[model samples]
Target: MANAASGMAVHDECKLKFLELKTKRTHRFIVFKIEEKQKQVIVEKVGDPTRSYEDFTASLPADECRYAVYDFDFVTEENCQKSRIFFIAWSPDTSRVRSKMIYASSKDRFKRELDGIQVDLQATDPTEMGLDVIKSRAS
Candidate 1:
């Protein structure tokens, strides 16, 4: 394994492609609030409080940063790739969402993989990811 500061164990060709891929694609870009002291991030819906969720960023208490945030909307399962995220709908077709996270990874395979992360959405089933549903009928 490469040292934490040195770099990633990746090839040059892949590096070039990674750059292009990331530049070409953007992530879901959901709104979020960061709690450094608590190491927590809460993902909120756009102008919709009834639909929202929160998740823990770290196991131990540590100082976190917004740079640690990520997209989670392109999920195939509950809490997609992790890092507090979301995805863009690829097409009008309901099934194949854009899944921006994949593009982010392709851009830099080992740039800074923030593993062991989670994202909370307003609904139990994130309408996009299909997690659970929250009864936010509106006040």
Candidate 2:
């Protein structure tokens, strides 16, 4: 019984560490177009919101920046101006096997993919491995 409990604790610790690494590796990007007439910048995040849906929008605290620069183009036809801002964040993609393999390799770990199944490089046969087993092995 104690062995089982200790094993569960170890599993939980590994799960938490895995999630921490995943979040650390996750990337976020925002791209939007702004017109000269536009007074405010609108932003939205996709996924489970920490706050209520209604309160999420209101959660964006307004701030004023003293120094700002923008490179904009003029629309001759409409006699207006606009700019497109691209905010890019690059991080690892954990969904795909290749990406996972790359990340693992970078960390001095190795992974292997066989017949559409992902497994540790040490795993000789992944035929019997399920999603849960593969995930546990990823740690």
- Best by TM-score, which number? 1
lDDT of 2 by residue, 1-139 (tens): 0122111111132223223223442212111111113322222232131333223222222221111111112243466553221111112222345433332232211001001112222211223222344333433
Weakest 10 consecutive residues, lDDT, candidate 1? 59-68
Predicted candidate 2, C-alpha RMSD: 22.6
How does model 2 score by TM-score?
0.17
Q: At residue 133, what lDDT does model 2 achieve?
A: 40
Work out the TM-score per prediction. Answer: 0.19, 0.17
Query: What's every prediction's RMSD, in angstroms?
Result: 16.6, 22.6
Tell me the tens digit of each residue's lDDT in model 1 across 1-139: 3323322233333234323323432322322322223323233322221222343222111221112222333333465442333222211122222322322232222333322224322211124333232112110
